[model samples]
Target: MSGDIQPDSHANGHLNGSSERPAPLTVAGVAQRLGVAASTLRTWDRRYGLGPSAHVAGSHRKYSPDDVARLERMRELTLQGVAPADAARAAVAFDPAHPEASPAPSQLVRERAPVERLLVDPLSLAAAAVEPDPRRVKRMVEQEVEDRGVVRAWTGVAGPALEMLAQREKTDLPGVEPESVLRAAFLTAVRDAAVRDDAAHRRADLVLLCADESQRLQAHVVGGGLAEVGVQARVLRAEVVQDPSQVLDVVDRRRAGVLAVFGAVPGAEDLVTAASERGDVAIFLVGDAAPSLWLPHVHRVRTLSAAVEEMAAAISTHV
Candidate 1:
């Protein structure tokens, strides 16, 4: 093999910004570097005998940097449909995963699920509900309802988890996004709960302001549910201006006393803080913006139904 050096190159590196090659890596370090659970590496060893090595002195099980490099090469071949055993042999025989050394995506995947695996854990039945098809997601939600009680289905299975998955579904992770459909499903669960006469009968004049069209769309699905609960809303899509004068202006001009959807702009807290100055209006937020981030000022709601519930709570005195 031509002696070349680069970081994470299964082969000698000429591409990565390195001059001299570094020494081989250890098994534990490889597992960390590859971002996988160590158990997976142990399994790969038993199944494929990959990166086999003995102890340095105490006969401790270990893998060398070169072994990690070889395994990485094998991962690439396997990704391209080659058998893992064949790939392992090819890598050791000077066929590596990279032309110049760099941490390959395949190596990362081989070690563990991607960094965003929590969002797509198949066992996380709740996470699977983010599909665009409302019917499919609702069906699952109904199933959850049957399995668990109404409140448990919402707070335990569907609450904070949906909030997190919504963030990741937009990320670059490759997986099925079943959020909207799931949201629809969970909404069905909450709405199915026996509607009690809301103690307070206050009218909620709600206004939704979002940064752009896409954010606006997310807000509407939420806003539509509120309308069902008798909280009338006028949805407005606006560019994320630095000042809240425009937001306040719309709220004032439209005579909307409640602002529940404020997520289009990332700096929603600032807007909520600004709205707080208006004191007469009640502000609520749903999304990554922490409820504790700006308490009392803005009620934090993760899902559409929660937003509606928040709206109901705020005007409880009148409702």
Candidate 2:
């Protein structure tokens, strides 16, 4: 770990030349050193009042040495299994002069929420979603997809975070802004990735459609992952086609051999039944909220990776 910047003296034995205080670190700089996201720091500051002491009217908040020390202590406590709220309380009460006086009892208790066990730091992406700059959030989503690919990134990070955000929205009454921003950014990123230049040459035999508008994002993510590995999955939103026959018409016209339906749309069973009549089309039920009713040759997949794999295999075989 890097040492915090001090204002006591210069590196040399001589006294410092100026009387001005050392400039406090920005959120990004402090976040980099602390091994956490800048948004996470902002969230801590907003929720726990552990913000920087050096504040300007028009500028970003800056973290002084003491502020950074408190944050470091907060991180340490949280890592030792303390709840964030309790950890923040302990961190705020921490005294720099007395190192041994840190909150050992809270750390020893190892208090954690049930949600934390389900997903590792699910609030990170949620925090990023509420950032002042939507562009930064979008860029972060694109970068995560670029680095981790659509399937893993969505499953491991975006999916869990969005789920947690939804739960928070229901219980905490946090407005829909955070979840909406994150979903839009994620959908935009994945849809951009799904676009292929050689679309005319490659046959898009896999058709993905969600009956519910809420499930469209997952469908797009699955389609995007399939596209990454040479399968150009055709994604259609529920709003575009109200009637099951409309999707069936596209499937029949395009000679699409694989059809994946997502979410609990009203006419999904009817659509699946019609699609099943055409023995050539392989049907797949994708996402958690997909219809439970199953027919012969119908496959069910609850995850993005699973949906992509099944659909890709079906497409490859059909082509």
Which candidate leads the pack in lDDT? 2
Question: Could you estimate the TM-score for every candidate?
Answer: 0.35, 0.56
Best by TM-score: 2
Give the range where candidate 1 is weakest over 10 consecutive residues by summed lDDT. 193-202
* Deviating ranges (above 4 Å) for candidate 2: 1-121, 169-176, 196-201, 239-241
Q: Over the stretch 97-160, how does candidate 2's per-residue lDDT look in tens digits?
A: 5656766645644455553122224466777765534666676677677656787778888888
Write one digit per residue (lDDT tens) for candidate 1, span 147-188: 443444555565555666666737433555566556666655
- lDDT scores in order: 0.53, 0.70
- The window of 10 residues in a row where model 2 has the poorest summed lDDT is 8-17
After best superposition, candidate 2 residue 117: deviation in angstroms?
Answer: 26
